[model samples]
Target: MIEFHLDGRSGVAPYMQLIQQVRQALRLGLLREGDRLPTIKDVVAKVAINPNTVLKAYRELEYEGLVTARPGVGTFVARTLNEEAGAVEPLRVELRAWLRRAQAAGLDPESIEALFATTFRIQLQESA
Candidate 1:
């Protein structure tokens, strides 16, 4: 199962956090095509957050063409690679901003690498 954690004091909204995590997973080549995600209820239970939050995140992911959800069946990651490659320039800017903030917060490269590794493993297991 994919494990999701929340920082109660984080300035980011729960849905935003979920969206960012999924995006990071995609960018880092963690989740791949045909990878299914947990149901909204399951995500709620795992993250200890409201189901609406998960739904919101899923909606945003859908908007980005990163995932698709069908009634009865759960949401699945998009099978297409480079689906968002056209937006790479903007994404690069965003990544740079995020990296600056992380660096300012004293999160070194090793810690960032570890975070990516852990998230990737969970996503792989969930997809498997």
Candidate 2:
């Protein structure tokens, strides 16, 4: 099961946010094919959103062939986006250490994120 959270400040529609979270989970190997998603009732209780919002997200995911809904059971992941699980942990550890170094240099979280985003964009542009 995956826990979902919303960021009201993200400017993304709530239903889209749900869909993105599911996609991100799939990419991160947190959600695998055949895993059951939280029921609409459970998501409504947890996030206090309209049930239709969850249904819409699930439907969109189904359309993408990432998930399927069974009539009386629950929604399940039908495919995953994860490619390489073995490489993620080491990169995560290195990123954590880099974050600590940035904090030690007196950069706040916002500054660190901005720096990372800027550098990431530059790298992408250079590669392109």
Candidate 3:
């Protein structure tokens, strides 16, 4: 029941929002190995987004080695987190850049916290 939230007005694309949330979950140790993700239809319904958006996000995740998709089955978090730890540095750099941009745009800590809270609830619902 993992629920996802995307800012329709954000300059970021919906699919990119999905991807960033997954990566953020990984970084924060929220999602672990073998966690099952909702099906594309479920994600679309839950997020109130297009099915293609969910599919695109899932496909990108799979490409990044974050999850695996099986035909007739479902997408599962990959057990490669340990192996991928070395790759987190790049993500850290990207996050720093994003933080700088957010700050420059006048998004204070409270605003960022609020955004995270709302999105986290959505994620929890989707993953549940």
Instruction: Quantify all predictions' global Cα lDDT against the true fold.
Output: 0.83, 0.95, 0.84
Candidate 3, residues 15-84: lDDT per residue as tens digits? Answer: 9999888877776677788888888888777778889888999999999889999888999989534557
lDDT per residue for candidate 2 within 9-124, as digits (tens), equals 99999999999999999997899999999999999999989899999999999999999999999999999986666788899999999999999999999999999999999999
Q: Give the better candidate number (2 or 3) by TM-score.
A: 2
For model 1, residues 1-128, the per-residue Cα lDDT tens digits are 25577887999998998888777777667777888878898888777899989999999989988899988988999754556777987988998897788888899999977876898899999999
Deviation of model 1 at 14, angstroms: 0.4
Q: After superposition on all CA atoms, what RMSD does each candidate show versus the true structure? A: 11.6, 3.4, 11.0
CA shift of 77, model 3, Å: 0.7
**Which candidate do you rate higher for lDDT, 1 or 2?**
2
Please report the TM-score between candidate 3 and the true structure. 0.62
Which ranges in model 1 have alpha carbons more than 4 Å from their true place?
Answer: 79-128
Ranking by TM-score: 2, 3, 1
- List the candidates' TM-scores in order: 0.61, 0.68, 0.62
> Cα miss at 75, model 1 (Å)?
0.2
